[model samples]
Target: MTTETPTPLVDFTAAAAEARAIADAAGVVITAVDEVTAARRVNQLAERVWGPGVGTAVDLVTALAHAGGVALLAAQGTAGEPATDVGFALGFLGWSDGLHLHSHQVGVAPEHRSRGVGLALKLAQRAVCLEHGVRLMRWTFDPLLAPNAHFNLARLGASGTAFLPDFYGQMADSINAGDRSDRLEISWRLDRALPSKRPAAPQANESLVLEADSRGWPHPTGEPLGPGCAVEIPGNYSELRQLADPRAPAWRQAVGETLAGAFAAGLTVAEFRNSRYLLAAPHRP
Candidate 1:
């Protein structure tokens, strides 16, 4: 017998009008939803894309399907079967050519996970963005989740752009009820520079520490940092991971706004030191 690669069954950028129709064509059905309610579908966008709930935590999208708000990628399992919905969308912070953000949902139905659906969907999104000339795609995820780390950094091809400890603060949801949600901000710098492939393996006992290499970390939310008594910050510092707190909205809001600000200022992450995954900044001084 011979085997051939499968093609993406649906186009996320092309399915803004009929979400359910897309699902029906994909052999996956959102049972309770029949008539299209923008509000409800928007909420689905928020929930399903919560990849961390499945150990691949991602952030909340723009909450709508405006021209650039969000989208759905659907597919059918078999002939005469309902289309299975498996993709999500993203948006730009403002009018910028190479800077934008996105959120997506990638998992097989309980019966289908461990299958290739997740990877298939991700590549589809990559196709949509690359086809449209999107230069960057960014999102947030919990770093504690190893599968996600391996997938984003290794599979789908993204890197840690920033780290937001306790990004979501706390949630009473079923998935994150008892754990502190520390997150890593990721970016797919779509260009000739970044490549999408897994590393051969974890480095062998290599010592790495991400030096401060700056005055101080940017905490634009200014949410109280006790006090600072020294000037001329050291080039190297050792700091432990951030405390996980549900009350920590500063991590996300501030980081999101400021990272967007840094990109506006022409700054990009230079590298990542593996020891603690310290996010390295461009040495533009």
Candidate 2:
């Protein structure tokens, strides 16, 4: 795959301020984790987000922090009260054509969902990367999860670059036990402005490559490759998994194959809206 031109240097001061403001608005305090105790807290938070028997070791988290990588913890509390860790983000330096940060894992506590905690953690991560002279950050996430897709592509203004099928093989975690570990790799340019707040509704002529039925079962439309198309995923994938619905696996396979094919056909994920990924033709030189 080809790489885009590097973004110009961002205003580190402004970025850090924005991160702090976001954390404050979310009623959390964001801080770097360099001590063993903080690293353990990160690991515990990860286990709670994923499941037992699955999380980065405390030693590794500390090593990454000491090595100049990002290891941040977000907690909620006030003065005179003990702060409780509610979210954490971990990443390390990477080389992809040039230097960048590969965000490994980021999670928020269950009770903190929909409270802007995840966005705050990500903006803080972006600020740390900019401070370290890195303008790009990449991460992989399950494409079937609409909330995550919106967070990465829409909220953070990242774009999906590649579709990786079964990227992690079989995961033993509670959230992904029987599901395929297919992922969409996304790239975030920290120097760029956040995406506009306008809605990303599909255009009139955009074809539907994959869509969900009324009952939420995924179906491939077999639409021909075109300059614009959209792929719809389930809005409540976790509920499907919880109920052991047979259509859950089907949605995974169908959406994965459809998106993989779209990427292979020179289509790029332009935006995600209404639980759908809108793909556009690659830009010409």
Candidate 3:
């Protein structure tokens, strides 16, 4: 009798096809774009996604692509046809903690958001990373953005480990303009299964270091009293900015200080529940 070998757990081709199907269902086609023309389109998409002064330049995209970086573009149209760029993800090799892909930026056009385009782009990124033997991807996002928090932590299974206040200083981008640019640094362990959003139930009398009041203003409620605690922020930063609310700065400071203090105490963001960050020390189970 001959011994049989079991199939490998990850099937890259199947995974890529599945991601393509997802984007296809949303009227978007995901493809690898390494050419100057395509890269230029992606550059334009970056501007649309991140706002002015935040988009990656065409030349930079070309250079990164030529340097063997990941240059994935999502387009609108049927397969095998010339399509217009609607989204892009750019990343490159890194040697900080072994060879990993430091996903610099991923952006979908404003008009194309909420259609699984971002998820498709990320799934494609995971497929590419697995193909190249890269098992980790790192990125940073504004912690105040609830949708991003949900997407990164709950949907994609990434782990938030650190908070960097004023990481990029003030920016001129329309989205981030006049903001302190605090970032939540997260890591995606590609080998793990992505988890669905299962936000933990909120308990009454839980120690909330920060929370929003009746008018959607973030206020400090308590200090870190145990290994675990919660920090809350308004779920809608864009709305506050659009309305030019005077409370935006207070929200930023309150949340920033709470997160900074918790992180400084060696706590990690375990989960986001009910717009509250479940922070726990590394020693906690």
* Highest-TM-score candidate: 2
Q: Which stretches of candidate 3 lie over 4 Å from their true place?
A: 1-14, 52-54, 79-81, 197-200, 203-206, 283-285
For model 1, what is the error of residue 149's alpha carbon versus the real structure, in angstroms, after optimal superposition?
0.6
lDDT tens digits, residue span 131-230, model 2: 8778889999999899999999999888888899999999998888888899999888897777767877657877898888787788788788666788
Off by over 4 Å in 1: 1-63, 86-98, 104-108, 192-199, 202-205, 208-285
Error of 3 at 222 (Å): 1.9
Structural similarity to truth (TM-score) of each candidate: 0.51, 0.93, 0.88
Model 3 accuracy (lDDT, Cα)? 0.81
Candidate 2 similarity to native, TM-score: 0.93
After superposition, which runs of candidate 2 have C-alpha atoms over 4 Å from their true positions? 1-10, 283-285
lDDT of 1 by residue, 1-285 (tens): 999453233334442223333344444433222223533443454455443333222223323344444344333356776545543333434333345646533444344444444554444445445556664677777554445555666555566666565667875554455455556667765432223343454445422221122343423333221111111112122121223432233323434454344444444433332312322344321
Q: Which candidate has the top score in lDDT?
A: 2
Query: Against the hidden true structure, what lDDT does model 1 obtain?
Result: 0.42
In angstroms, the error of model 1 at 16 is: 18
